[model samples]
Target: MSEKSKNEPFGDLMKSMNQFFHEKPVKNILQSMDDFFKNPFPNSASFHVELKEKDENYVITAELPGINREQIQLDVINNYVKITVKQLNIFTTEDENQQITKKQQSFQQSTRTVPLPHHINEKKVKATYENGLLTIKVPKEKGKRISLDGNE
Candidate 1:
């Protein structure tokens, strides 16, 4: 038999099997599995941001552990706020009594950017870090309206 005909039988079986089950249902099952594995660790070393709005300003707090103040950058462009933090792994060797041991391992550096609820004055922004928590105070733009009318 020719090579083409030799594989025709298997191909036909596969086609029949595919026709047996609806493609959409099968695809949904596979997609659900993919999403489950995509975020294996949902809360591992991930920073959580909390925004509190007051009469005159917004207080933004982020839990950033193992990050130094010098490694963070904050910027406000147009109406969006961006914050980038970088952390470096530090290794140390210590001697206990008379034995010396070396330990080596590092965590991956990650960056996250969040959009603010309203426009903020970048010049008046204040940031402070204490006990692995970063607190930022952004004075809300006084004249700017939080919503725009249909006219413009």
Candidate 2:
């Protein structure tokens, strides 16, 4: 008889053998832990906007990083402006040094809608993108009454 066989009890050995063969729950728990650690942020995307009024135009700037231009959509109707950004997740697997390597990649996606303080000329709206920043210029509506007209 082997030394290990002699040292271990028969009942304990049988239980261990059963556990090794029936490992579905253990495998599920391990997989859940792996997914939890790999995805710390479930949402995976965020954004911020800055609005400024300069002379005859309202300048709106949005910060979007790690996203492609094709995944972004913009719409302006009346005084409401809507912006949408989408990003896809990419996963890669490889085997190195007898170990599995997994790499997860994701991009930014967000949407924002805001009402302009004053009406704008929709036909004259212009948008520009540079270094992951999107700048939109909307010409202010002409002859609009100022709210502080009677205050001063």
Q: Write the per-residue lDDT of candidate 1 for residues 1-152, one digit (tens) a residue.
A: 78876968688778878875547888788787787798767655556788888888788888888778887777778666667776667676878774547766666655555566666678888888998888888887766458766965
lDDT of each: 0.75, 0.81
RMSD of 2: 15.6
> Root-mean-square deviation of each candidate, in angstroms?
10.3, 15.6
Best by lDDT: 2
Candidate 2, residues 1-152, lDDT tens digits: the string is 77876887596779987797569987788788889997866775657888888998888899987667788788997787888998778887878764648879986557888689766567899988888898999888778566655756
**Model 1 regions lying over 4 Å from their true place:** 1-45, 90-107, 144-152
Residue pairs with colliding backbones in model 2 are none
Candidate 2 deviant stretches above 4 angstroms: 1-44, 92-108, 144-152
